[model samples]
Target: PPDDWREACLSNDLPEAGTLAVTLDEQVFCLYRVEGATYATADRCSHGRGSLSEGILEAHTIECPFHQGCFDIRTGAPTALPCNRPVKTYATREADGVVWLNTSPRDVAGQP
Candidate 1:
């Protein structure tokens, strides 16, 4: 396991193509499963206080229930109106039936 990785939950705990919210070290994160792959991001929507875990999951995107804004689950990039700022993302993976979440921010364009 990576030094910053922490066990989040069992892989089977997540519904297929859905979202789950988990708290680590007092921070909330939304976990997602899409096409057998897992992803993680800050649970709060960048545009509002809406909880991403309660929002709609569509393919690789999550739609904020507050304003109907959408974000790409893979990169946390906003993909719809009312959500221009990118949400914080974390590196996530599934191994041995367990889902692990990296405490460090996900690297994007060589930036973290």
Candidate 2:
């Protein structure tokens, strides 16, 4: 059975408009708490495999630390230059002050 997902976060842990790095079953993803809901995406950037967890967040996108590539928080689409490759994104939501992620297998992760 899959994990409840929300168990990944403890009470009063997530920060508003902040990013959180989480590992689910060995898979690493950057969890972003935007507005109030939670969004998950691959922590590695499409350009040079940079650590996106350290990237900057603007509205609903994040800027890659390697080459300033921008990506959407919901779909993980390339939103800026220096990168055009799409990254994997997972389904996420928040409940009871904790964030939940659906780390299920993807056919072609991040694509609509």
Candidate 3:
């Protein structure tokens, strides 16, 4: 962790093309590893109460478990319907083999 960022998980903990659920200060987030890069977003689907961590990962998209909707893991944009709204996205980085999240909106580099 550094400054405003919080430690989420070890970089190695998330398998290749895998997703992991993490909670920080009561807020739930999903960590993803794809194509050798890591991404972070809210664990809950924007369209419903779907748990994204339990959802399927296809390329850069995460399919909502409840409604089968999909969202881009990197930008949090809804890529498939039944989900028109976007999930909150966070900036992520890997340091010392650990995944770190910049939960602050201002610090986040990704879009909603």
Q: Which candidate ranks first by lDDT, i.e. highest? A: 1
> Where does model 1 exceed 4 Å of error?
110-112
**Which ten contiguous residues of candidate 3 have the minimum total lDDT?**
103-112
lDDT of 2 by residue, 7-66 (tens): 556425667788878887787788887776777888888788788889898879899888
Misplaced by over 4 Å in model 3 are 106-112
lDDT for each candidate structure: 0.89, 0.76, 0.86
Clashing pairs in 1: none
lDDT of 3 by residue, 17-102 (tens): 89999998789999999998988888989987889999999899999999899998877889999999888888888988999987
Where does candidate 2 have its weakest 10-residue lDDT segment?
103-112
Query: Best by TM-score, which number?
Result: 1
Arrange candidates by TM-score, highest first: which order?
A: 1, 3, 2
Q: Point out the higher-scoring one by lDDT: 1 or 3.
A: 1
TM-score comparison, 1 vs 2, better candidate: 1
